[model samples]
Structures are given as C-alpha cells and as structure tokens.
Target chain A: MGVSVLQPGLATTVQDVGRPGYYNVGIPPSGSLDQYSSLAANLLVGNAEDAAVLECTYMGPELRFGSPATVAVTGADLPPLLGGEPRPAWESFAVGAGEVLSFDYLRSGARAYVAVSGGFDVPAVLGSRSTYALGSLGGLEGRALVAGDELPIGDAGGAAPGRSVPEALRSTHPRHREIRVMMGLYDHRLTDGGRRTFAEATWRLTTLADRTGMRYRGATLEFRERVAPFGAGSDPSNIVDAPYPIGSIQVPGGVEPIVLHRDAVSGGGYVMVATVISADMDDVAQSAPNNTTRFVEVDLRPGRRARRRRAARLEALREALA
Target chain B: MSGAGGPGAERAPTVAIRSPLPGVFYRRPSPDFDPFVEVGSPVEPDTTGALFELMKQFFEVPAGTTGTIAAVAVADAEMVDAGQVLFTVRGS
Candidate 1:
C-alpha cells in the first residue's frame, strides 16, 4: 500500500520503539515519546509491536491512501476522519483505495500515533526507523513530514480481520496536571528546604517545554553551600555537575525545574535531583503548556514491581487480541 | 584618553560569555571537585568547562573560543538569565 501526505501538520515523523545501545556515542535512543499508544496502534492493525508508525505532534497530517489497507489511530485523542466521516480510535478499520484520511487539531494529548496493517516502509537507520530531528538522521530526511511526501507500506495481502483493543489495556487519557517523580541520582545536592519545596510546591509548565525537555516555573531550589580553595584560600562555593537520565529534575542556580525527555542529551555537569518513573513518562509527554506538575517519591523495589506488573498485563492483553 | 587614537574615540565593547538558558549556574564540576576552568586559564572551542541543569537534564555549554579566562561574571550557585554574561574570556 502507498500513502501520501497532503497537509503535513505541526511535526509528524515515523517512529518505532527506539535506537538503544548508542548512548555512549552521545546518540540518544530516539523513539516514540509515548510507546504505549504507539504499540497499541500497531497491534490493532495486526502489525508487530515494533512496526514503524507515524508520530503526529500537536497537529496531525492529512493522508491519502493509494490502495486499500487497514489502519488504526491511538494516543492524544486527535479526532481522526476517514473520507469526511469520523472514526473511532484504538481499533482497526479498513480504508478503500483512493481514500483520504485526515486528522484535525488535537483536542487532548500532545501527540498521536497512526499505524497501518503493514508498517511504514521506511529504511531503518542504525537499527531504528525513528527520527532524530536534531542530528538530522533517520526518518524522512531526518525531519518532520512535509506536503507531498509519499510513504511506502509493505505488502500485507490486504486488510486484516478487525481487532479490538481490550478496555483494560486502553489507556485513559492522562491529566495535564500533576506528574509523578522519584528522587534521582543527585537528590543529595538539594538542601533540606529545596527538597521540601520540590515535594510541596506545584510547578507550572512554561512555553519553553519541548521534546528536549520540559521547563517549569515555580519555587527555587537551593543547594548546600560549599568551599572552593584556590591555591591556598578557600572561597565559598555551591553547585556541582552530575549525571542525568530521562525524567531527571535539575535545579540550576536553584531555580526553574527542567525535566529531560526522550531527546535529552546523554551527559552533562548538572545536579539531577529526581527522575520521573517510566510509568509516568507518558503522562509527562502528553502534558500541555501551563499544566501543573508535582513530584512524588517512591521506593525503587516497589517501583520495579509495579513496572513488571504493568508490562505483564499489557502483554496478556496483546496476546488475547492477537 | 589613554590610547593613541584621536579625542572622542569610542571605548571597546566588553566581551562576556553568556548563559544559554535561565537557570542556576555553577563553576565547579562537582561539590567536592575543582572547576574545569578558572580565571587566567586558557579554553578552546568545544571545551566542556561547565553545565546548567534544568529540572534534571544537564546541558553543556562549549567555550566556543580559544582564549584566556578573563573574569568570572556570575557567582557560583547564582541564578542567571538566558544570554546573561557568565564569563569574560580574552581571546588569546
């Protein structure tokens, strides 16, 4: 099957799971920010969990199908239409040859995923089909979709049998406010008051938020004072460089918390005080501007257990549907 | 007045290293360690002298020039604005 972009919205790119094992070379694993929704859309269309799909951001693209095919939409609830008729998301549907599929401005979530019966036939780069825009690698010329861009699809014989996503597996749309996080690698650098403010105060998402990271405006966090000795004399000093990970919260100059995302740099010298759990990453990714977020601490062992349970549940649901 | 130029000559513009984003600024690599670069030390482009952490992501700001560290404009653990001067490097 063949698909062509008519109106390329805000930022649309092909993405799958991601390219891991390249962090040591300063290359981040660029993949779907919301893996849950991406996988759901793929599975609904009978595609493998890692099949490449279109990741639409904020706005979505207008597409035309050159041949009959099965497709599904998931994530962010962007109202998707097939040939001028509204279609439900999270379920597979067949499209006639020469049909036009379009998505309107997102009414909810910041991102949406579209999957075809046979995944998008884009050549993979370094073991991934996802786009990393900054480095100008992967996807369609390493950038967002543009008008007139034709996307090839693998031969899938035709539309597969209809499939339904389990109600329990279907994600309830996340709230824009209140993100959960666990204390991170550099939590010790924060002063007692700094720690209290982080847990107690609510932060407002700023317009500066993006795929790189989310910036917040709220209470300023402080670090314990230190002494810097130059030659012989010691001058008062505070602030240190440290490692970071996805969901790390760093308070530079003790002000404004920035939450790193999928495209965040691999390393830097900054105090990373906390990391948002993986379960909560989807919620953070979908948060719109001006949303309020609060940090919550959880123990590692319990957190790991919760993650395992969630994974098992998702796998079971996928197997039943398959 | 001290130069050999004619009267009413304009003074040279003061050069400064600006902050890339608004956040807390630090000079040292860690609490228990010495800073990567200090006053009078030479720095080259791509030199990772310091970093700024926002939320939890740390962004490294390159020196972008080969020069002697002239002065430290922002203090350790001081809040800074994007594009605000953080250091003054005299080109070598």
Candidate 2:
C-alpha cells in the first residue's frame, strides 16, 4: 500500500518535469536534475513522462514495500537491490509485499530517479510535484526525505517486469564531459584572455552542487577594466541584477563558475558569461564532483536540434517500453 | 546483500571497503590527525577506515564488515571513483 522509509539515503525528493511558466514570478522551476532520465523512469513505470519520481543523491534510500508494487530505477548508475538481490537500472521490476528495496553506491552520474507504480501520490504545487526547497514549495513539503516517513503509492499501471530501455537511447554520465553552452549577455565584460580561458580551459564540478545551482573550479576569469555602472556593484563581475535564465553560468570574483539549475533564484546581479543549452542541461546535472567539464559553445541551430533529438528519443522510448 | 560479499553479521575472510561516491579519499581524518585505520588494526563492522570527500562534504567509508585492516588499496588523499576499493580487512 505504501513505501516505508527504513533509511532515507543521502537526499531523496519527489520531482516531475517541473512547474513551467512561473519563472517570471520568482518561482524557480525545481524539477528533476536529469529530466530525460526522470522521464524514462516514469515511462517504464507506466506513468506519464512528467510523473513525479524520487531523485536520490550520492547515497540512496532503504525502503520496504508494504504491498505488491512495480518499480523502475534510472538516471545514475546506482543499482537497485530488492531483498538483497541486484536489480538492473533503466528497467521495470516487481516487488512482493514486504520486500525491501535499497541501492548500491553510485558508480556513475550524481542523481538517480526511482519510479513507482502509479507514482508518488504526492500533492502538486502549482500543477507540479517538483520540490523547491528554498521556497518550501511542492513535493512532500518541499524538502528532502527523512527517516520514518511513509510515502503513499499511486495506482500501478506501468510496464511489466523485465521491460527495459534501449542502451543507445539511455543516457550515460561520464567523469569528463563537454557540455554545450551559448556565450553572450556579458562576454563583453571579460578580457580577451578571460574569454579564451573560459572557452579553452576545462572546469571541474565542485560539491557545491544542489538543486539551486552548481559551482565549478578552474582558471580565474579576467574582466575588462570598467568603472562601476549605476546599480552595479564594485566587483568587475557584478552588474545590475537581471533575470537569470536556467543554466546561466555566473562567475563571481572571477573564479568558480556557478551554473543555475532547476531550483535557482529567479534573478541575480552577476555577470553571466554563458548559458548551457537546454538539451545538455541534464548532463550538467549528472556531472559529479571531480568530473571535468568543458563548455563547448554552439549556435542556436545546434541547440534547437539537440532538443529535437531528445524529444524524438523519448518518443521512441515510449514505444520501446509499450 | 545477505551473502556473497554482502554486509551482514556473518564476517567474511576478507572484507573490501569501497568508496560510495567519486571523490578524494583521505586516509587521515585531517592533515594533523592520524589515519583512521592502519594495516593490522582491528575494526568492527561500523568502524570507519577513511574519509571520502566531494563537493566539500565528507563521507565516512565504513568497514561494513568486521575485520582487521589487511591492506590499504589507495594512498592518502587519492582521488577515487565510486565502487573503487579503498582498503581490505582480514576477518576472524
């Protein structure tokens, strides 16, 4: 009838595709970090592409099923264990009543999504189950799961046991990844060397990653010498606060670029040198600390094309499972 | 896991301590502190052998199985991936 929390793991939360159309109102779209993987988990479980699922961080949860259930684990390479037996990722499986489900250590990627039959049965905030912890909005009270909490299970209707996603279509997270970005907005503020280093040098993801934003370490960026503009701060990287687009990369103090994610502030007063394209953002979320990432700049056409390719793959995934 | 390298009450002859996440593995608690466990050191299932750091947070690498430190697979402050064995313990 429900999943009882034996151990809540590192950080597990209920999330969906996210609450769109409200960024203008200062509400960050706090959804799954890896959207494609989230969708696949949901699809395998016979839920909608955007159905709510649990996003587990470095460690995973220990749960006992109160009743028969269908489940799927996707995203990170954290393999699921049922009654101490290994279960494959990216596939649907069955759990008998009273069976315990846990996970192994993460092998690749940073987040893992768990999709249950029917879904989380959590109430949606603003038409979505995503959690925005900063605002304390949505998804099981808008925070990470804790021990002793019981989660209601949705009515089961997802794929049968042994149904799995195609390997080619399944996304994999590598230790080193070249993420696509679009430069602009404040590239003029950077000195020529700064721009070159940003484009040429590799950056390492820092543990400063969460739902709000992720930080990276690398060569320091230099800004063009300029007097502080009205409403702008004295730091060369400071500017009149502006709305921050999701995936915008802001470097403060000329070092450690921060990429805003699904649960970031709506606006900020920092100079944004680049924006990670929509299609590749999932990869950015999956990047673990110590993982090297190079921001590969791309044109608008390529960005849009990447989005289309993702949509096509998802459509094919639905068919594959069906 | 109840058997075959799983962590449980029954101890295996040798226990493998692995990093659960990718990060820098620190043998000592701090630069000034002594290493958590050295070779031949007795340890319990819950005993921590090392610290794995990532994103500025520290996670303890527990023995998970009771034994004595048999070998250190990684050096102090070495970067390791998840599932990478960090140390081995010989059980009673």
TM-score of structure candidate 2: 0.91
Share of native C-alpha contacts between chains A and B (below 8 angstroms) recovered by candidate 2: 0.64
Q: State every prediction's TM-score relative to the real structure.
A: 0.73, 0.91
lDDT value, residue A241 of candidate 2: 94
The 10-residue segment of model 2 chain A with minimum total lDDT is A154-163
lDDT (CA) for every model shown?
0.75, 0.87
Query: What residue runs in model 2 are displaced by over 4 Å at the alpha carbon?
Result: B1-14, B28-32, B54-57, B70-79, B90-92
Tell me the lDDT of model 2 at A50: 69
Which candidate achieves the best DockQ against the true structure? 2
Local error of candidate 1 at residue A24 (angstroms): 0.9
Which tens-of-lDDT digit does each residue in A46-152 have in candidate 2?
88776789999877999999988789999988989999999989888999999999998888999999999888878888999988878989988778889998988
